[model samples]
Target: MKLHTIVGVALAVLVATAGVAAATPGANAQDSNSDDAAKQGPPSELPDPVPEFVSSIHDAVSDFLDGALDGSLGDAVNDVTGSSQSPPTSADR
Candidate 1:
């Protein structure tokens, strides 16, 4: 009885897998047709905004860090050293 049950279960799984495999090609063909249609449309200059937004945020953070290091940190160091020298400007570089 156990052997019969195992054979039945295996046969059912085989049938299910074969059915899925047979159906997959048709589904993929339909998808490819739709993809081809989409490809025929006008190309985008920029399809994704993620990299642009990321670079903008990166620039903002870098500018903030530069200001903190060059402006505030330099003044603090100068105060500790008791030096009358001003923080170096970009033009000084």
Candidate 2:
């Protein structure tokens, strides 16, 4: 429900802003400022996404998967066994 609301809002904003940049080549001029896109500068002052954060997330996921495997290895193996759990039928797909 929260996701739907956020997505709806985002879609609405995107729709509203659609063709806006192109409609006015002098976009900044409308706002009474520089009209150059590059001159406007990046909104985010920070650097591009840091690799350390990505590595941390990856490590966390790896630890979770490892723990899950250790705790439920049998269930995981059974999941792959066609005899135990048949492959998804067309209807399931």
Say which candidate scores most in lDDT.
Answer: 1
Residue-level lDDT tens digits of model 2 in 1-93: 699999999999898798685686773354545366446657767768865445644554565577744434334444434248644557988
**Candidate 1 accuracy as TM-score:** 0.28
Clashing pairs in 1: none
Summed over model 1, clashes come to 0
lDDT of each: 0.68, 0.59
Writing each residue's lDDT as its tens digit, candidate 1 over 1-93 gives 699999999999999999988877663364545767677657667565564445544554565577744446556555555679998889999
- For all predicted structures, in order, the TM-scores are 0.28, 0.24
Query: What are the runs in model 2 whose C-alpha is more than 4 Å off?
Result: 26-93
lDDT of 2: 0.59
